[model samples]
Target: MTDTQDELPQLMSHQSFREQAREVIRGMIVSGKMAPDALYSAPKIASDLNVSATPVREALLDLVQEGLLRPVRNRGFQVVIMTAKEHDDVFKIRLLLEVPSIREIAKSSPTANQMKGLYDLANAARQFAREGDLIAYLNADRRFHISLIELLGNKPLTELVASLRDRVRLLGLANSGARSHIVQSATEHFELLDRIAASDTESAAAIIERHLRRSRDVWGAGSGPA
Candidate 1:
C-alpha cells in the first residue's frame, strides 16, 4: 500500500519528539512553572515549546493518565492540585516507603556502574540547582532517587514512590529563601549515596528522613497545611 497524504500529519507523532515533549511538559508542571488548577491548552504549550500540537496533546493526555492533570471539556488540561491534608498524607506515605527502602538498598552494594550513573544524576541535580534551574534539577533529582530505589529490584515499589514524589506540591522550591536549602538537599544526595555505599543503613535512613522533611518543610512550604 502506498502512503496517503494523511500520513504527513503522522510525522508529528514521532516517538522521540512525543517522549521529549512529555518529559519537558511534565517537568514544567512538577517544577511549579505550571501553577496548580490552572488550565493550559495544548496549542499554547506547543507554541511556547516550538513543537507541533499533536505531540503536545499526546503529552497532556499522558499526564492526565498519571493523575497530574485533568482534562476539561474542549478547554484544556488543568493541573491537579491537592489539598493541604492530601499533600501531607502523600508526604507521610513517601517517608514510610523511602526511608526503610534505603536500608535494603544499602545492603546490596551497588555495582560500580550503578553508582557512577547515580553520581552523574546527583551531580547534574546539584549543578542545576546551583544554576537556579529548577526544572532541570527536578528531572535529575527524580532519576537519582528512583535509581537508588530500583536497586531493591521492585518495579512496583519504584513506580509508586516516583508517582508519590511527583504528586507533591512544591510551592516554594523556587523562592530565593529556599535556594540554600535546595542546594543543601541537592548536596545531600551525595551523602545519601555515600552512606548507602558504606552500608551504613541507619545513617542512610537518617539522611533520607532529613531529606524528606526538608522537602515537606521547604518546597512544600505554603503549599497548604503547616
Candidate 2:
C-alpha cells in the first residue's frame, strides 16, 4: 500500500465500515455522480472516501452480489448495465407486488396522519421536480410510493419492493435528461394522492398501475438496451 493508503482506517473485525462504504458508493451511483460502466478503482475510491481499500473492496463485492455491479475479467468492477427487457421485467414485478399492497392500504383507510405523510412526500417530490432536482425528486418519489406499500405491514413484501426500487433508481437516473418526464411523474403523483385521500381503492390502484406503466414507457423510449 502507498503512504496514502496507510492513512486509511484500519479494517477491524467489525462490519460497520463495509456497510457504510457500500451505502456511500451506492449513493454516488444512484445520484449519477458515478457513471454507469465506469470502472471502480478501490484505490481511487479509498482516496476519495478517506477510508481503507478493504472496506471499499468488500462493499463492491456486496454490490456485485446484489446485481448492482459486475466484476470484469482482469479489471476492476463496473456498474451493472440493464437491458430494456430487464427494466420492463422489474417494473412488471413492482406493479404486481406494490399495486396490491397500496390497494390494501387504501382499502384499510389509512389514518389522516398516514395520508398526510404520503401527500407531503408527493408535494416534496413535485417541488423537487419543479426545481429540476432530479435526485431529490427521485428519492422523494421512491419514499412516497414505498411508504404507501409499507403501510400494508408486510415485511417480506416491503423488502422485495425495496430491492426492486434500487434497480428502478438506476433507470430513473438514466432517463433524467428529459425534463417533461418529471412533470408527467409529478402529475401522476398528485392524481394518485387525490385518489388515495378519497378512499377509492380501485381508482388508486388503477392510477398507480398507470403511473408505473407510463414510467416504463417513457424510460424505455429514452434509454434501453439496443
Candidate 3:
C-alpha cells in the first residue's frame, strides 16, 4: 500500500476519536508514562496514537480546560506539573466538602442499597490492592468517595469533587511501597463504610478527616511536594 493508503486507519474513525485521544493521553499522564514538565504537541501525540492531528488537538484542549495540561506558545501542550501545595489545597477542599457531606449522610443514614453499593466498591478496592494494582485501586477509591458524596444528590458538588480527584491523581501522589500501603488504604475504606452504614456521621467525619490527612502526608512524601 502507498504511504497515504497505509495511513488510512490512522485517520479519524466514525467513533469518538477526540475522546479516545483524551483518554489515551490522560492514561499516559496519570500512569507516569508522560513525565511531568514534559512537553508534547498535537502532532507528536497524533503520531503516538496513530490518529490525525485534529482529534489530538481537540483532546489536548479538553485536558487544558480540566487543568491537567497547559497550552504552549508555539509548541503543543505541556503537562502541568502539580506541586505539593496544589495537592494539599485540593485535599483541604475535599476535607471541607467531604466531612460535612458525610456527616449529613450519617445523620440521614444510608439506605440498604446505598450501603450495599459502598460495600461492593470497598471490596473492589481491597481486591485491587491485594493484586498490587495501583491504578485500579485509585479508581475504586475515587468511586468510593464519589459514591458517598452522591448520596447528597447534588450534581455540581459531585462533579467538582470528582474533578479534584482526577487532578490529584495526575500529581503521581498515589505511589506507595507495596501491598502493605495499598492494603492499609483499602482497609480504611471498609472502616469508613462501617461508620457510614451505622449512621455514625460524627465518627465518619473524623475518619474522613484523618484518612485524608494521612494520605496527604504519605503521598506528599512520595511526591516530595514539587
Candidate 4:
C-alpha cells in the first residue's frame, strides 16, 4: 500500500509533464517551428524540454493518436502533412460547430466564471498578438474557442472540434499573412466576446462567421500538403 501510494504522485506528475510537453510540441508544429516531413527523436525533445524521456515519449504517442504525428520504426515521430482540402474540411467543421454555438452562448448569457475565463483568454491572445508570439497566440486562441464551445456541456463535440483545430493549426496558417494580421484577428476575438457578453446573439454569430472566414483567407491561401 505504501509503495502504491508513493507511485501515485509520480504518475500524476508524469501525466502533468506529458500534457505540458504535448501542448508545447503542438504549438511548435502549428507555428511552423517544426516543419512537416521531418522526424524528431524523443531524447532530443526531452533534452530541450528538460524533462525525462518517459514523459516526452508518452506525449509523442498521444500526438500520434491525434493524427498530427506518426511514429517511425527507429525515428521518433514525423509531422503529418495536411492537404488544402483537408484544411478546408477542418474549417468547415469549425464553422458548423462554432457558429450556432456562439449564437447559443450569447442567448444564454455567460456565468461569472465563464465571463472571467473568456476575458482572460481574449486578453492573453491580444497580448501575444502584440508581442508577435505566434505560437502563444494560437494556443490562447484555441483555448478561447474550446472554452466557448464547452459551455454547451457537450464533451464529445468539444473534443471533435478541438481535434479539427489541431489539424488546422498544424497546417502552419499562422506563418503567413495571418502573422501580419495577428492584432486584427485578436481584436476580432475581443469584439466577439463583447458581443457575447452583451447578449447580442445575431451580431456574435456574424462575428464568428467573419472571423473564421478571414482566418481561412489569411492562412488557407496557397497552402497545401507540405
Considering every candidate listed, which one attains the maximal lDDT? Answer: 4
Pick the winner on TM-score between candidates 1 and 2.
1
Q: Candidate 1: deviation at residue 4, Å?
A: 37
- Which tens-of-lDDT digit does each residue in 19-92 have in candidate 1? 77777777777766677657788887776666788988998899888778899999898888677777888899
Q: Which regions of candidate 3 deviate over 4 angstroms?
A: 1-28, 41-59, 174-179, 222-226
Q: Which digits, one per residue and each the tens of the lDDT, describe model 4 over residues 102-143?
A: 999999999988998999999999999999877778788889
Error of 3 at 31 (Å): 4.6
Worst 10 residues of 3 by lDDT: 1-10
**Candidate lDDT values, in order:** 0.78, 0.73, 0.76, 0.81
lDDT value, candidate 3, whole model: 0.76
The digit string of per-residue lDDT tens for model 2 on 1-226 reads 2323332344344667788677666655555556675787877877766778897889988878877778887778887877777877888899898788767777888899988898889899889889876655666776777788788788888777877877765643545444677767887988987887788999999998888877767653666475
- In what order do the candidates fall by TM-score, top score first? 4, 1, 3, 2
Alpha-carbon deviation at 101 in model 4, angstroms: 0.9
Ranking of candidates on lDDT, top first: 4, 1, 3, 2
* Candidate 2 residue 169 C-alpha distance from true site, Å: 4.5
Q: How much is the lDDT of residue 11 in candidate 1?
A: 22
lDDT of 1 at 203: 96
- The TM-scores, one per candidate, come to 0.88, 0.75, 0.77, 0.89
Question: Clashing residue pairs in candidate 2, if any?
Answer: none
Q: Relative to the unseen true structure, what is the C-alpha lDDT of residue 36 in candidate 2, on a scale of 0 to 100? A: 75
